[model samples]
Every structure is written in structure tokens, then in C-alpha cells.
Target: MFHLLDIKKHDDGISFDQTVDVKAQLLARDPDIIDVDSVHVVGNISFDSGLYLLNYDLTYRLVLPSSRSMEPVAFDNQLFISEVFIEEQDVASKKELVEDDLVLILEGDSVNLEDSVVDNILLNIPLRVLTEAELENEDLPSGESWSVLTEDQYQALQEEKKVENNPFSALNGLFED
Candidate 1:
């Protein structure tokens, strides 16, 4: 839940501060998240010409489970803002409302600010994810599961496919016919 503020009419430029609640939502979505410490999000955002621009910095830490212990991972980066736009369009047949509607557009360097948040979260994710020892040992009921194939397993599968579909084998069949 990223805070959006000061979205009102002002004679001068509008100013607002916000704190994005990414960590809490992420953990809630994935209970396996053991720790999410020191997540920092800093950015400057502005709206102009029906668009929003955001430049930002992100830093965070993630903990992943291993066979013996949890592995700590860190991420730090800067991102540019690109585009932010309003999501409203007037219908041809509908009567115009008394109050004027304001739409915000986001693009270019400002768009990077939004992308930075998502990118940082993805970067923090473990390429090889595992559960803690306690969860691994527990006998849980059957449900949907997701896992990554190891390098060796993927290579072996590819090799097996190659042998089954060799071009030379097809040539031999053609000659026999």
C-alpha cells in the first residue's frame, strides 16, 4: 500500500510524502518470508502534462532457507521514473458531470520510480527458494506447489530430447522408404 497524498487543487505546485508498504504485503502473500529487514524506498515524483515522473532509490534484504541455515541476500539500486497516467475516459453518450475530473499521467523518468519498486522486490526474491527446516520436515496436506529445476536436471532432460530427435535418424528413415 503506497501512500498517495496531496491529490488536490493548489495554486502553486503540489507537495506530498508517502511511505510504500511493500514489505508487509509481500510477507502476507508469502508466509515463508522469514525476515525482511531494512527496506528503504526514496523517490521524487512530479506530475506535468498529463503524466507523472518518478526517480527513486531502493535497498532491501531478504532471507532464504537452505539445507543448514538461512541465506541472507541484499539489494541496492537507483531507477528512473517513466510514466503515470489517469485511467478515466469520457463516454460519448453520457452527460458530463458538474465536477471536473483530473487525470494524472506517468511516463519517462517518472515511470522509473514505479518500476524501481517492482524491480527491487523481484531482485530480492531468491532464485533458488526453499523452506525452513521446521517446515521442510512437517507433513503437510497436498496442495499446489512450485519449484525450480536444478541445472543438472534441466541439462539431462535437454540431452534426452536431442537423442530422440536427431536429424540423422530422420535421414535414415527417408532413405529406407
Candidate 2:
């Protein structure tokens, strides 16, 4: 947390470079995350034009279950974020300034960087994640009566089904006679 009063007093702004352990907090928010490394945040908060601007670069390693398989996979992430912080009373007047930017309305006298870090981490989670071996293997999973197929394979199968199930297919012999 960055105290607004302290930052506003300094012309150059307040800079922060630290490692934060948010594993318990993150796991509480999202049960899907298997584990996470300590988060590194390096940036400064500058007060300008009646607003506090936050700029930071965050790095962390997150472990999550694979999309195809349930095995845990580690993902390293580096992200840059710039956000505007507005006080509750100023939100209505400063809506235009924040419309085109990422902004957070401050509920107190300090800025919650941890919450921002957590939110961004959740947003950055990939839709699909595969293990190293899974990437190398070309085979899709299969069961006794059902099998996963590529898009092209599925399209071709659908075409074959259309031809096979055509009601007019049975009338072809009558027309030939």
C-alpha cells in the first residue's frame, strides 16, 4: 500500500522495488492456481493533475492445471501496467480522464497495489496450457466410442455424414430406372 499523503509531498514521487509473497492471497481468490512464486513489483507512484498515476512492472511464476490434462504447469509472466487512481469524490468529475485509461477508485488514503497485481494475474491466465511433453505429442485423447478430432477432421466427417444421411440418396435408383 502506498500512502497518498506521503507521495503527494514528494515532487519526484515515491518509488518501490520489492518482492511480495501473495501465494496465500492468490490461492484464496482462485482455487485453480496450484502455486505461485513471490511477485516482484518495481515502479513509482506520481501525483499529478489531482490524480495519482501508478506505473509498475510485475514478474511472477504461476502454476496452474493444464487445459487438456490436469497436471500442474508453471508459467512465467512479465507485465507492465499504468493506472490512474482517483478519489471517490473526484470520480464523477474525472470520468473523462479515466474513460480511455485503466483507473482505480481509491476507497481509502492508500493505493492497493497488491489487489491490482492479483487482478492482472487473473486476467493474464491463458485459456489453454499444455505441458512440454503434451506439446510434442500430436495425438489427441480418445475413448472407446468417442474421440477428440481436429477442426479439419471434424468438418470432413460432417460432410461425409451429410452425404450418407441424405434422404434423396435412396431415390437415386428410381430416377436412374
Candidate 3:
């Protein structure tokens, strides 16, 4: 279960804690997703120095029996306390909720950390759910292959290859004494 606590008013700021059932929420919201095994979430919200910070960590496992080409997705990530800002108005009305800023920070090795950590676990959801057989089958070419090079390394290699094959190399050789 995944839960988010509502912000409570305090002299300097607000603080709260909550736990939510993610699988049930997802199932209720979107019937297309099925076979959710379990979900666990824990976090806290605190306000300080005119800023509101929400820190949360989550771990979940899902079953995608419908998918035929991919693996069943499981994930874990942490949301760090980063920044906080306030929005004076929302699309619904002109009234403001709080006077402080709200900022969220997320750090992890998996993709969609920002979404999971900031977006309240909505964006981290797998686009396509897969079953056990789908996950085990090696013949399926569904997901992207992992890469080894950093951006800098890739750029450097490209530059080196270009210089080695440059057409001007022939001109330089012709001019050689």
C-alpha cells in the first residue's frame, strides 16, 4: 500500500505521514492494469523556513499476465527533500493553499524516478504490463538494451573516429616533405 499524509498546519510549517495502497488505487483508477501483487510506501512531509518538503520512499511488485513480450515490472526508489515553492492560484480557483514553496527531490538508478518521487508514483508505472512467461522468455525483443558508455565517452569516441577518417588526412600526406 502507498499512502501520502496531508500537510498539517504548524507555527512554522506543516508535517504529516501517510501510507497508501498503490495496487488498489491503480486497479480502481485503471482497470486495464491487473494482477497487482503488493505495494509498500512510507514517507513524511515537513514544512520549514517558508518551504514545504515531501519525502517519500516506495517498493512495489506488479503482475502483468496480459503482456506477452516483456517482463513483469518491480521497482523501488526514494524521494529526497529538495525544494519548495507556492502557487498562488490553481486552474480551479484563485485561492491559494499555502504560502510556502514546495520542492521534491528524487535519486535512484531506475528511470521515472522523478515521476515516481514527485508525481506520487503515477509516472513510474510501467507502460505495458507483462506476465511471468513474458518476462522469462529470452526470445522476446521488447525492452531496450543497456548501454555502457557515458555521454562524454560516446562523444569522444565519435570525434576520434571522425578525425581518423577525415578526408583532409590525404591532403596533409600529399603536402608532407
Candidate RMSDs in Å, in order, are 10.5, 2.7, 10.6
User: What is candidate 1's lDDT per residue for 1-177, written digit by digit as tens?
Assistant: 222233223323333244454666666666666566555666555544433344455555665454323554333333333324432332222223213433233222223333456545655565545355434564432446844455787799899999878877656657665
Give the alpha carbon lDDT tens digit for every residue of 65-132 in model 2: 98778899998999998888898888888888668665777899999889888888888988888899
Model 1: lowest-lDDT 10 consecutive positions? 90-99
- TM-score quality measure for candidate 2: 0.86
Question: Can you tell me which runs of candidate 2 are displaced by over 4 Å?
Answer: 97-102, 166-177
Off by over 4 Å in 3: 1-18, 22-24, 69-119, 128-132, 140-177
* TM-score head-to-head 2 vs 3, winner: 2
Please give the ranking of all candidate structures by lDDT, highest first, separated by commas.
2, 1, 3
**Lowest-sum lDDT 10-residue window in model 3:** 104-113
How much does candidate 1 score in TM-score? Answer: 0.43
List the candidates ranked by TM-score, beginning with the highest: 2, 1, 3
* Predicted structure 3: clash tally: 14
lDDT of 3: 0.45
Among these predictions, the greatest lDDT belongs to: 2
Models 1 onward score TM values of: 0.43, 0.86, 0.41
